[model samples]
Target chain A: MKHRGCGKDLAKVSEFIDGGLPAAMCRRIRAHMDDCRPCRDFVASLRRAMALHRAQGRAPSPPPLAKAELRDALRSCTAALKKRKPR
Target chain B: MPESESALISRSREGDPAAFESLVRRYEDRIYRLAKNVCAGAPAEADDVYQETFLTAFKKLRTFRGGSGLGTWLYRIASNLCFMRLRSNKRRPFVAALDLPSGEGLRLPADSIPTPEQAAGKRELAEAVARALKLLPVDYRLVLTLRDVEGLSNEETAKVLKVSVAAVKSRLHRGRLFMRERLAALSEGAA
Candidate 1:
């Protein structure tokens, strides 16, 4: 078997975080991170960045203007439908 | 029982505007945020994309054949509109450095502890994140937002972006690296 260097493992770090790898492979990466300080820091950083991004998603609600415009459009579509219906 | 999305979709396809409106209400916030992020936090651009997405979805509602969830379908529409707008305006895509030279000597201690309270106040952290995200190229930003931010599964994200799963993963990996490096600076500043 070919030796998987830090570069290769680092490339797959996201996959590992995602649980996309097989259990054995996950264990291998875990073992590698245990001894590899750089890989450890890299994975830590990736996880933190993702967490921050997710937080960013939660901070802002959809702007009110966008919602109002969409509602208005829906109402217009509804009005058009009513106009076409036989009374 | 309340109508399932499929039933709502059925009624929507039959010219029931209320049904369609309900669907829009269900997904409007998500679609808007996606647009906002895809437009790199430009509110005006986000608003345009949000409105256009629903209008397009409304115009083409009949083409929806219950293959995917309503959210997934809407995301596909929103994603397309966002990218189209970005391309028409000739925004440069951010190119990621695929081969990271090494993390060996880099001393970014701020990467380790990153809870909301520890890094910065919630609002500050969010602003930092938004600023960092905006610096990324559209493709990388989209991939990161979909997977990491929007909480979409890899397969679902690939479907939304109309890319292969491998492509999604590759983009996601590179995007993650870009975001990590960018945010590390913010984190250090905040600390």
Candidate 2:
């Protein structure tokens, strides 16, 4: 895939996959990929990797005890702020 | 009807605890998840970032000005705290080794592409993803988490990170490549 323009085109593969490129640019990239084996493989692999992460969903949330602690802390902080307010 | 976010903010700024608490509840899970992703190796620090983000937001509510959305505001605060904690601990930013070996060996074999079900069932692969993510610099990790894991758009992620959309795209592309290389190696090893 080290062809003359392969590097330049591959650099845009991410944006290409994301549809961030202009329509004509996407067509050009697509045409380039049709003849480029490594670039095609790379794009496929990158897409799969992205899909894997997307499927992984959100990171684990704070634990229940931690959530409770945060709530309590916010409550106290807000209460103190309320008390300090001028009439 | 549920109270609008601006209304909630108005009450919150006036020292209304319930209103502030309502805002907190709306975003705590997301802020915590962001903290966890940004501070993957430091559970305690994640908690601190999560706690401090809301606390700091509360203290600074008057100055929020609504220039950005509230969620972006909270994300900015949390991200700053995460980076500050890393800096204080002398953890330098990770620069990806873009010069890593390429060619046939680095390509992901087609058969290894896991279906969603396969991906979900493969604990080792999930761990590989997590491990690879942890190896990325905080900037890349944060971008990947917000843009990929949390499903925020590139523009939204840029707003949170206070970078341009171009910067977000660059980071996300490089980060995804780094992760793909790591996962390819894992698949090869398992084969």
Best by lDDT: 2
TM-scores for chain B, listed for all candidates: 0.80, 0.80
lDDT of 2 by residue, B36-61 (tens): 87776577888999999998999999
Q: Score the docking of each candidate (DockQ).
A: 0.43, 0.46
**TM-score, each model?**
0.83, 0.85
Model 2 reproduces what portion of true contacts?
0.40
Which runs in model 1 stand beyond 4 Å of their true positions?
A1-4, A81-87, B88-121, B189-191
Span of ten consecutive residues with least summed lDDT in model 1 chain A: A1-10
What is the per-residue lDDT of model 1 for residues A11-79, given as tens digits with 9 covering 90 to 100?
Answer: 788899989999999999999878876677777767767776776675366677767877798778767
Question: Candidate 2: deviation at residue A54, Å?
Answer: 2.4
